[model samples]
Structures are given as structure tokens and as C-alpha cells.
Target chain A: MKKLLLATCFLMAGSGTLFAQKYMTRTGKISFNATAVHSPEKIDAINNEVANILDAKTGDIVFQVLVKSFKFERELMQEHFNENYMESDKYPKAEFKGNVANVGEVNFSKDGTYNVKVSGKLTIHGVSNDVTVPGTITVKGNALSAKAKFSVVLKDYKIEVASMVADKLAKEATITLESDLTQK
Target chain B: MRKSLLLSVLSLGFVTVSFAQTDSLMNMLNSGAPVKNEPVAATFKATRIIDGSSVENLGAGVLDFRISHRFGDLSQGSQNFFGLDNATTRIGLDYGITKWLMVGLGHSTFNKEDDGFLKIKLLKQKKTGMPITLSYAGSVSVQTTPAPTLPTGDTWLFSNRLYYTNQVLIARKFNDWLSLQLMPTIVHYNLVDSSKFSNNTVAIGIGGRIKVSKRIAITGEYYYRATNADMTYNGQKTYNALSLGIDIETGGHVFQLMFTNSQGLTDRTFIGQTTDSWGKGALHFGFNISRVFTVVKPREFRDTKATSW
Candidate 1:
């Protein structure tokens, strides 16, 4: 009888019972920083992105990348980023479908913070790698906030760090994303 | 293409239309359909809504300074001077046409006494969330005559060029800083010399705009002929030359500096009269200055905004 009850309970908590949520923001920001000086200062280009979240189920979330939204402030950096680092002209969109585990009465409508894990295939610069990033999402009624920090090896993307400026660009890039999301 | 023009018209039927130089140049030139309340490209974004040549908001206007110096004057030196290259310089002005157009007027101390033209954005900005910029530009002016040569027959000459360009932003948020743009063009010359190189021809150009930071952007563009553009005389073809240039934008102005194998910004002059060799191309340093004018100078700009430009 106990086994029968557990089986019935599992069926009740299937994907059908999983609530979906959405968040959006135009001002979402994704930034990166690299250090290279006049002496032995050959460094690779660094870039980042902050996209919006679509209808995401409790167990998994999704985002649509603003392909042309990527920015590079330096001429050399911008050029190298395109020709060598991220072949944006070929693969323009990046998607992430990750899950957030562990939840107990987590009110997305209430003003509170929740620690979560983001795991998904991040496609960028013509390569996609699975990633599990530690992040947080906060909510205050309809107001939403999200933040995450992660690092990736540029080589994973087939990015050929130019031998000329590789020193400036660390093989490992530190990335950060922060945004104030609004629920429709 | 009429299709592009029609598309622009169609877009305007829906809403409306931007400039600056490097990332600024790319962003302003590329951003196409204005998504309501979207963020302006990185820099030189106006504060007002620009609708079909009408302004609902007036953003900041800048004063740009450019000094361009070509290596030689064929007129001043003649056949002897034609082959003997040196450098000449000039300054000019450019203003945003709309969100998608930019117009420019400039003068030089060499062959082109004064010249002006207009450029229209074709595609949308890559970083501002749009991809590609297809623009069209047509310019006309008389080639200058060095002293003693006198302003003879070709004084009021005219030349028109139609050019198309596309810009794409790579990776990074102000970090990677990269972009590549290509231009295909057709130049029509009012006066074509009997020489083989003097005829109007369809050429190709390639340019790159890179931003090193929020305040400075570096850009380089070159024009080359797909067919033989050299004057073939007595079994000799004057080598086809190419132009190389760089631009920097700051505050409200952009400064362009360059070294071109060809001194002429026109089709005929650069194609035929080039004195530079394959590897021994002449170094011509030059620049252009751009300034903005308003039917009604912003209330605050009336007095203090007078640019040193």
C-alpha cells in the first residue's frame, strides 16, 4: 500500500504540476574586464552578455540572446574578437536551458532571495559547452533581480587567441551578469 | 538598390530613424528599425526620437576635426610632379542625416578644393541588437589644380559614387572591441581621360571599425579597383593603389588620420594618376572635421556650444 501511495505521489508532481515563470529587462548588463600593460602586455579580448529569461518551468529556465547586442569597445579588441575570438557572423544566438533545484514555498512573487544553479549549453563564438553556474534570483512582488558570476576557457569556443595579444587576454575569462527583471 | 530604399520607406511608414565615429560610427550607421524605447547604440545617441527626418528629441551634437594630407599633387608637379609624390592635407565636416543617414562636406588644399556627399544606413547596428548596415553615398566635386597650373577646363567637374557597406560586432561587452565592414562601390566620372585608367570603374572597398574603449574608437577603410585601374601607355600600366585610414571619436567630435597609396578620394584621380609603387606606396597623411548645425541651436548650445572645430 505504501509503494502504491508513493507511485501515486510521483505522478502528481510531474511536469504538469511545475509552474512556469518569466522575466524581462532591456537594461540587463553583462560585463568583462582584462588587464594588459605596456610591458609584455599581449592580451586576448574579453566579452560578456546579459540576456532575458522566457517562460521557464520551476526545474528549468531559458533565455533568448540578443545576437547583435554584443558589444566591444576597442577597435583592435573588436576586430580580433570577430576574426579570432568569437565568430559572431557565423553563430549569432546563444541559448541556455538550465535547472534550479531545491525549493520549498519559494514565493517568486514575494520579496526574497533564493540560491540556485544554472546548468545548460551556452552556445557562443561558434561552440557550445555545458555549464553549471552558481547564481541567485530575488523577487519582491513583481520586481525581479538576477546575478551570476562564472569563468570559461576561451579555447572551448575554438577561439584562437591571437599570439600577438594572447598575453593580455587570459586563457580563462571571468564573466558576470546582473539585471533587474520585471514580470509581465 | 531600390529594394533597400523601398524598405526604408516601408520602415518609415511604420516608425522612423542616427552618428558618431568607430563603435560610434558602426552603431549609428547600423541601427535600422527603431524599436520603441530601445537603448541607443553605445555613444553619440541622441536624446530625442528621430522620425522620418523629423526630430522629437535632440541628442548631443559634436564638432569633429580631421586633417588629411595626400602625398603628391599631379597638377602642381605635372608629369614630372605627377610621378613625384608628396603629401597634402585638409579638414571637413559631417552631420547625422537621420538615425540612418549622415551627410558630409569637406575641403582640401590639393586637387579637391571642396567636396560634399550623403550616406544612408543600410543594415542595423550589431551591438545595439541589429545586424548589418547597408548605406548609399553619392558625392561630387572638382579636382583641384596646383598653382601655375591654373583652374583650367575641369574647374567645375563632377564625380558621383554609390557605395554600400555592412558592419558586424564580435564578442564582449566593451571588452572584445571588434568589428568588420565591407563596401562595394561604383564611381562615375564626368571627365574620363583617353588613358585606360581614366575610365569610370566599379571598385571594391574594405573597412574595419574597432573600439578600444568607451571614449575612443579606431577605424580603417581602403578602396581598391577590381579591374586594372592603371594607365597603360607604351606597354606600361601604372600600378593600382589603395587607401588606408584611421578615425578616432571623442566627446562630440571625430578625428580621422590616414596614409593612402592613392591621394584622390575620387575614382579617376586615384585609379589613373597614382604615382606610388607596389611596395613603395607613398605615405599621405590626412584628416576630416565634422560639425553640426541646427535650425534652432539648442537653448544651451546657442552661446557655449560654439565648437573649436
Candidate 2:
């Protein structure tokens, strides 16, 4: 009976460790800036309700953002972005699924910061593209945080801007992401 | 030894189940779960579909300046240059107070009418569940035309020249290319020509848009007068209003070219006072031009003084 109890405790400890590798966050922040070089037009939006999950065991990461949740500095610009550019009604969410290229270099059990390369397929406006971006992952005891800055060309995602206002918008928009996650 | 073996088997089963749970977690992460109850948008591109009000509303703090022109009936022939020579115009400004609330004022050359209206959206269709959108609109109009002849002792009362309309608009977007709407409307005119004509009328309007291209749509609207006798002018029977148009959406403007059997633009006149018949070739060519301007800066840009981007 004592041997059975010891075996059961051992299995419980192993299962707990397996579940601790998954980290999740619901309140991640994502922002984008598109400032035209020649014109005075500046378009910027922020979306704070981003959900992301990371599996440290397999080095898999996933991100989801509701396109309509993005708020712009100008209400009219927001409307145009959703109705004309993003078509949020038809494609409501933008998602990414990728993996950490160098998962062996970082130790999730230790308190440290590691710069990593993440490669994934990002789907935006019903179009998917393979993307690789450099990001930093920070571990502080039980908490994990990640941040990245990247730029994407609008034409690559089939987002067409009319020539009338093409000068007012940048061809490439700079995007920044930050997330503070807790182990689940 | 047998008891220890059974315990070992149980521990192995628990470990296997826990490992399987991780696979399930990965599967859940891979499948993108759809977000629920997001409100559907852009069911109709413009707030007004042809001659009738659409289910759409302007964004908050936005102003819409609109000009509507209706030429004389095509049956007028070349003498009137196919209705090109005679034109009745209406100029209006609509303002959005909220996402679902709007107010507007308009002046029309027909009957020299001055009109104002308030529209409020009560419900919106959501992607997760809600199937239709509902809105309530109310309008008040006053005829400003001077009476041609008046008896010495008789006086014209301002209240008698006033007209009111109450309507409920229900709309549904069936798909990306098609949308339909129904409006149950009631119009009241305080004074009429005689007891022969009713003071109040009920109408049901059906309208739809079929997208033929990315930037153009074929639109039509018909209003059926369910109650009241038709008003006659020179022994001709007036018909219910019917309009067919094409909507072209430019970057910042929506231009609608229509052929309608009604000469008036206000709800009181268009809904209850149409005097032209389509079968008799009384269709009038008209166009509506809409332009929107942002009157108030957004909350983020309101306090910022940095102009150089």
C-alpha cells in the first residue's frame, strides 16, 4: 500500500509539470502605425484585447485578434479600415500560429530574457502568409512576457488602396505587440 | 505482489490520460475558435437607399451633406427636354449624434417644404445570433409655400400645414451580395384638400439591393399604400411610389441615379402624394449626391496639437 501511494504521487507530480508549460494571456496589446512620408496624414490604431497562447514544451505559439476591436485615432479612419480595407464583417479575426526557432536555447524554468526568432503563418483579411520576426521572451518566476516589432506590406495581404488616398497611407505599416502571460 | 501490479497499472493509466490531455490542448490551440456575437457591419453602404431611409446610420460626429435632384417627368417629351429643363432640388444636412442615433434637416423645392427627422437604431444584427436590424425614424415637415389665394376672412394656420411621419425599418443581410429591408410607415397630414382624402395614411415599403460589382449595386424601392383613397389631379389616378436606381460608391461619395414615379421627396408627399404612374411613362430621372465630413475630431486627436506627421 505504501508503494502504491508513492507511485500515485509520482504520477501526479509528472502531470503537473506537463500542464505548467502552457502560458496564456488575454489582455495583450497590439498597435500599428502608418504615417505617410509626403503627406500630413497619419493613421494609427491600437487593439488591447488580444489573446495569445504559448506552449513551452513544443515551442508552439498562437495569437488571435478581432479586427473590429482595433480602435483608431480617427473614427472615420477606423470605419474605412474595417469596411474598405479589412472587411471585418467577412473576416472578423486575424490569427497567427508559429514556433520558436531556438527553443533549446531558452530555459523556461529559469528567470532570464532570451531573444528568439518566431516563424509562422499569419492570416489577415482571409489571406495567409509565412512570416518570420524577431522577438524577446522574458521569464520572471511563474510569469512570462513577450514583445515584438515588425512591418508588413499591405499589398502582400491583398489590401488595395485606391489611388486617390494612396498617397495618404504608407505601403508598409509597422506593428508592435506586447503580452504579459501567466502559466496555465 | 498482485495488489502492487494493479496499482502500477492504475498509475500508468493516469499518466497516459494526462499525456493525452496535452495533445487535446494542442488541438484546441490549433483550431481557431470563432469569436461570438460580433455585430455585423456594412449591411448597406449608405444611410439612404434611393428615396427611402436605409438601415445604415452615420458614424458619431460625422456630418453628411446631401443634394437630391428630380427632373420633370420623362413623358413631358422634348419640349421639356426629357424632363431636363424642369428640376426640383432638395438640400439637406444629416448629423450623427451616436452610432445609432441621427438627426437631419432638409429643404425641398417641391411644395416649398422644410423637413426635419430623427432616426434611432434599436437593434443590430450580430454574426453570432441576431438575424435582423431594427430602427425607428420619425419626421416632421412644414409646407412653407405661400397660399396663392385666400378668402378675406379665412386665415392659414401653421399647424394645418404641418405633416408628420413615423416609421419602423427592419433589415436583413442575407449574404455578402444581397440585403433586404421593410419599412412600416404612417404619415399624417393635418389639413387635406377635402373630406374625400384621408388625413392619415399607412404604407409598407419594401426595398432591396443586389450587388452587381465591387463598387456598384442595383437598388429598387416600392411603397404600397395600404389605406386611404388616392388623390386625383385633372381626373388622373395617382399611383403608389416606385423607384429603381443604381448606387455607385466612390471613395468619399455615394452617387445614386434613379428613375422614380414620384415628384416629391418628403415622406408626407412621396409616400402619400405620388401622382405619376409608371405604366403611363411618368418616370422622372433623379440623382442623389452624398458627401460626408468629419465635424468633430476623435477623442485621441482632439487634444493633440502636433500637426506635422
Candidate 3:
């Protein structure tokens, strides 16, 4: 009877509250397909990373990007990409300010797959836009998986392409996100 | 006549004193004059593009002071410091010449090697219909090993890099204090030494910024260079690395902490030759604390406008 009580106490102590989970990956590719006849039908990694993703309860979701810290291979492309395209030095960073579901039970012990819409505002290149993305949260014992897919238009913000290679770029871009969460 | 002779001699003494002061300044500091050059700022990290839009050329001065440190280097021999086999720790000044042109000279504290580089932005990036920012950056570096291994007569080493980055906002201001920038990058290397340098490699990097206050922010990024970057040398298996870092901003000063799989921080050495997982090891732990100083005031003769152009 005493052993049974101890087990029950341990269960109660572990009940409630979603664990703080963080996921990270930099090898995930953010590639661009450019069709320049002389440039060949080639693809390139844009020196991008989803450094970290932190999830928790109480309606708090935060994200950050170090504007000046991206890397690439080609000296030519890297120079133009930074000096001409992204004004990283001046702005230095872009961030996401929003909340996860505040009222949800934030079930920590359940073993099931749940679907929810993650809504937040994304600011980049000095412009702000609102985004509502549909994603899934999976709970398997103590681990969680958060996944989402979304699309954005560059024109929504006021970023203008220079006249030289105006016709060589894309207008619409797709962003896909997948992350695994662990106990914080 | 005696009075005139004394006046001339005093004037000559003053001229000599002024010349000595100017020469000493030239030898002690990178920028002999305190006037900071405001050069064009174009960086290849794609997230910067997605966050602020395309960068234009401009001259801006860099900080006069750089506080840099060293942890340890990978197993590469000590001769490769700065264009040799490897290079570690670089701290120096940068001057922006045009809105799009920047030049800098830095020294590696580990090997007492020095290098100078020029960066240029090719195109003014514009937002796509969907808020996509694209840009390109190119730089050339001249690094010299403290001692040359290839005949003392050969003392100079050169490295070049070209990169492209694209950044986008996945979720913006869910409220007022947060935003996210998705950045991607590609770099190219030309003119690498055969002994320790790898062929041009492909890598990916991502970064983001979180704001806790109006003027303060937290920033981080990660980089993964492909293993294909390594070519066979004397029959050995080599691999590139994955690096991650963060930056804290307060006014004009930005403090950065970096954990890299490769210890060489210069463009040629780190990107060209990487060993050991900075991700798993303790030596790759590095930090760069940098500050940006702007030249605000000009005194009389220092201001060219004071003279007739």
C-alpha cells in the first residue's frame, strides 16, 4: 500500500503543464532554382537556417534571425546577395512575435495527433505581414512533432528588385517548417 | 637676420614634429585617421535580405576596437596560419568606400598573420510579389602567414569568395515584439592552396532575430557545409562542419557568440579546410564582440570642405 501511494504521488507530480521543447536543424535546404541560359539551370543554398524553435504553453511563441550571419559558397553570388539584396548590416535581424494557443489544454501526457492553426505576424526587410498557417502537433509519449507549410508574396512588402536582373528572380516563395520538440 | 633665422628654424621643427605624429598614427592603427568610412553594407546571409530589403552601396566606418579571443584549432599544423595551412582569430577595421564598396584589413592573433578584403554588392535586391529578398555578395582576401612555408620569398596568400542569400518572413509580428527571417546562402571559393584547402564547397545557413525591447534584440544562425567540399589529399577522409552562433545588440555595440565545427574563422581557412565537429567539440567555441563607430565630427582642416575643392 505504501509503494502504491509513492507511485501515485509521482504520477501526480508529473501531471499537467506542457514541457518546454526546442528543435534545431541547419542542413535543411532552402534552395532556389534559377534558369539563366549562360548561368546554367542551377540551384543554390541561400545561407539560411532554422537555428532554433522553442515551444511552450501560456500563449508564448518567439523566433529570431541574425540578419548579418548567413554564409554561402560563391564569392560573387554572396557579395551581390548581401550588398545589393539584403540590407542585413543595417537592420541586423527579423523576428516573429506571437503566441501559441493560450486556452488549449496543452496536453503533455496524451498520445495523439492534434491539428491547429498557428497564427502570427512576420516582419522582414522592414515590412510586416500577418500569416495564419495550418499545422499539426503530434504527441508520442514524451516527444512532440510540429509541422507547417505556408506561402508568401514578396510584393506584399515593398522589396524591389534592381533593374539589372529584374527578370531572373521569382515572385512567390514557399516556406515549409518541420520541427521535433523535447522536454525543456 | 637672426630673428628671421630663428623663426625659420622653429617652423621647421614644428613641421618635423607633425610628420612624426602622422607617421606614428599610420603605423599604430589600421585607419590612420579616426574618420570612419561608411561603405555600402551588403551581406550574403539571406535572412538579412528578407528582413531589411536590398542593400545599397555607401561608405561607413567600422569600430576602431575589436575584442577577439581564441579557444583552440583543429588538428591542422601550425604553419597554415592565415593563407598557409590555417588561420585563427581576426580583429581589425573596415572602411566603406562607396555605398556598395567596403574594404578592411585584419590580423589573426593566433599566427600574427594579416589579411585585407574588399566586398561588393552586385544588385539592389527587390521584394518579390511574395516578400522574397535576393542578393549577392563577393569578397577577396589577401592573407600572409607569419612565416612562409613555400620558400621565404613567397610570403603572400590570396582567397576569394562569392555568395548569394535569400530571406523571407514566415511569420511576422504575431504581435509587437517578434518576427522571423528565413535565410539561405551559397558561397564560392577561388584560388585555394592545394596543401590544406578544400575545393569550393556548398553549404546552407539560417538565422533569426528576436526583440525583447525596442532597441535590444537576440540573434542566432547556423551553417552546414557539405562533405563533398573535401577532396582526397594524401589519402584521408575529411568533412566540412556545422556552425551556430548568436548576437546581442545594445545601441551601437553588438556582442556575438559562435560555436563552429571549424575553428578557422577566415574566409579561406574555415570554409576551405574544416575538421572536427565544432558542434560536438569544445575548441570550436568562439566569440566575436564587435562595435560600430561612426565619425560624427570633423575639425577644420580634417573637413575637406574647409578647403576649396
Candidate 4:
């Protein structure tokens, strides 16, 4: 009986460590901006309710954002973005899943900021593309913060702007993400 | 030795249980299902598909400027330019006070009536569980035209010129391309010819839209009056209202071109006063143009500088 109790305790401890290695945040922020070349027209939106998870043990990360959650300055632009560009009803969410390319370089136990490279498959508007972007991971006690800024080509995601107003839209949009995750 | 064997087996069970729990947790984290309550979009693009009100409403703080026109009956012949020479037009403005409430006012050339309505959404179809969207709209219209001079009759009361409509719109989007709606409606006329018509008219409005393309849809609507009594004016029997339209969506604008036998643009006139017959080639061509403007910024994007991504 003593031996069996010891074994069960060991197994529980092992699983507890596995759970400790994961961090998550539900209120992450993501924003994107597109600037027109000739026209003064600019389109931008912010999404605050982003779900993000990070596995410190394997250096795996995932991000999920609802396309409809994005809010824009002009309500009309937001409508067009969802209905015309994203077709959000058909594709409601955009997601990213991958790993930290240089996981060994960062020490999760140490309170320090580390520059990292993340490579992942990003799915948007029902299309997926492999993306490699530079990001930062900051560790402060039990809290972890991650951020990344990248540019996405609209055509790569099958988002088309009609020729009539094409000049008012940029070919590429800059996306920025920030998440403060806490250990599970 | 037996006790040691039992301990080993118990240890194995614990290990497997722990492993399974960890695996599931990791899998769930990796496949983070997006936390979203995304409601179905574009069930019907415009507020009105054709002659009947659709299940859609303007977003909060959005203002819609709408212009609707119905030409004279096509039976008037080519000499009248196929009814294009004479037209009854309605100009309206609709505003959304909140996500679930909207108000509208319109002035129609027919009867020189001024109409106003309030629409409230009761239920919204959502991914969570709601299967259909439902809304209620109440409209009041007052005719400004002078009452006809009677040879020997009582004076026309102010209340006699009033008309009211109550409707409940239920709609469902079956797929990306098809949407259907049913509207149970009641139109009340304070002063109706008692011998010819009832004071209250009941109607069932059926409307649907099939998307032909990303920006275009084919829409049709019909309102059937349930009252069996005949509505006659100058020895002409009133017919049910039927309209077929094509919706074209452009950025910030929705244009709908339609053909119908009803010349009235408001529910009171269209449902209770339709005098043209489709079987007699009295179809009238018409069009509705709607333009939306954002009058108030959303609370979060109120700061212009902060809104710049």
C-alpha cells in the first residue's frame, strides 16, 4: 500500500509540472492598419478579445481571433471588411499555430526579455500561409508577455478589393499583436 | 511479492491516467477553438427586400437614407411611356438607436401621407443556439390630403385619416445563398368604407432572397390579405401585392429594382389599398435606393487618434 501511494503521488507530481508549463490569456490585443498610397484613405481596426496560449515546455504557441471582433473607425468599413473582404460569416475565425524557432535561447525561469523568431501557419479567410516573424518574449516572475509585428499581403489571403476603390486600399496590411499570459 | 505486484499495476494505471490528462490539455491548447459568439451575417442585406420589410436592421448609430418610387401601372400602355410618365415616390430616413431598436420616418406622394415606424429586434440568430431572428415593427401613417366634399354627410374626423400597422418578422438563413422570412401583419384603418372593407386587415407577408453572386441577390416578396371581403374602389377589386426585385450591393449603398402590382410604398397603402391586378398586366416598375452613413462613432473608437490602428 505504501509503494502504491508513493507511485500515485509521483505520477500526480509529473502531471502537475506539465500543467505548470502552460500559460494562457483571453484578452490579448491585435490591431491592423492599411494605408493607401495615393489617396488619404486609411483603414484600421483593433481586436481586443484574442485568445492566446503558450506552452513553455515545448515553446509552442497558438493564437485565435474572431474576425467579427475587429472594430474599425468607420462602421461602414468594418461592415465591408467582414462582408466583402473577410466573408466572416463563412470564415469566422483567424488562427495561428507554431513554435518558437529559438526556444533554447530563452530561459523561462529567468526574468528577462528575449528576442525570438516564430514560424507558424496562419489561417485567415479560410486560407492558410506559412509565416515567419520576429517577436519578443518577456518574463517577469510568473507572468509572460509576448508581442509581434508583421505585414500580410492581402492577395495571399485571397482578400480582394474592387478596382473602383482599389486605390483606397493598400496591398499589404500591418498587424500587431500583444498578449500578457499568466502561468496556468 | 503479491503486494509489490499490485503496487506496480496501480502505478501503471496512475501513469496512464496522468498521460491522458496531459495529452488532452495540450491538444486543447494547441487547437484553441476561437472563443467567439459570431452571429450570422447578411441574412438579408437591406432593411426591406422589396415591398415588405426584411429581417435586417441598420447597425447602431447608423443612418439610412432611402428613396423608393413606383411608377404607374403598365396597363396604361406605351402612350403613358409604360407607366414611367407618372410615379409615386417615398423618401424615408431610418436610424438605428441601438443594436436592437430602429426608428424610421417617411413621406409618400401617394395620399400625401407621412409615415413613421419603430422596429425592435426580439431575437437574433447566433451560433450559440438561436435558430432564427425575430423582430417586431409598428407603423403609423397619417394622410394629409383633404377629405372629399360629401353631398350630405358628417364632417371627416381627424382620427379617420390615421392608419396603423403591426408586424412580426421572422427570418432564417438556411445557407450562404438562401434566406427566407415570414411576416404576420395587421393593418388598421380608422375610417374604412364599412360596406366594402373591414376596419382591420390581416396579411401574411412572405419574402425570400437567393444570392446570385457576392454582391447581387434575387429577392421576391408577397403579401396575401386574409380577409375574404372584396375591397372595391370605383368598381375595381383590389388585388394582393406581389413584388420581384434584384438587390445590388455596392460599398455604402444598396440598390433594389423591382416590379409589383402595388403602387403604395407604405404597409397601410400596400396591404390595405392595393388596387392593381397582376393578371391584368398592371405591374408597375419601381426601385429603392438606400445609402448608409455613420452618424456616431462606436464608444470604443470615439478617440480619432486611438482609432488609427
lDDT of each: 0.47, 0.84, 0.44, 0.85
Q: How many clashing pairs per prediction, in order?
A: 53, 0, 102, 0
DockQ for each model: 0.03, 0.37, 0.01, 0.40
Q: After TM-score superposition, what is the CA distance of residue B65 in candidate 2 from its true location, in Å?
A: 2.2
lDDT string for model 1 (B105-148, tens) is: 66665564566655554544444655443445555555555433
Question: lDDT for model 3, on a 0 to 1 scale?
Answer: 0.44
Say which candidate scores most in lDDT: 4
A19-103 in candidate 4: lDDT tens per residue? 7888888789999988677754567789998888887877778888888999976666787799889998888789888788898
* Candidate 1, superposed: residue stretches over 4 Å from native: A1-17, A20-29, A34-58, A72-84, A104-110, A163-172, A179-184, B1-99, B103-114, B122-135, B140-268, B271-309
- In angstroms, how far off is B119's CA in candidate 4? 1.0
Q: Each prediction's Cα RMSD?
A: 16.6, 3.8, 31.2, 3.8
Tens digit per residue, CA lDDT, model 1, A47-70:
233445533334445443544455
Candidate 3, residue A5: Cα displacement in angstroms equals: 98
Q: Name model 2 segments beyond 4 Å from true.
A: A1-5, A34-43, A73-84, A87-90, A103-114, A138-142, A162-165, B1-35, B233-237, B295-309
lDDT of 3 by residue, A61-139 (tens): 4444544444433232334444445555455555554455531745656877777666677776677787777767677
Report the C-alpha lDDT of model 3 over B23-117, residue by residue, as the tens digit.
23223222222332222222222212111222322233322344544456443435434223433566767555554566656676533445555
lDDT for position B249 in model 2: 78
Q: Give per-model TM-scores.
A: 0.47, 0.86, 0.38, 0.87
Tens-place lDDT digits, model 4, residues B118-185: 99999988877999999999999999999888677688788988999999999999988899999999
Q: Which candidate would rank higher by DockQ, 1 or 3?
A: 1
Interface RMSD of 3: 31.7
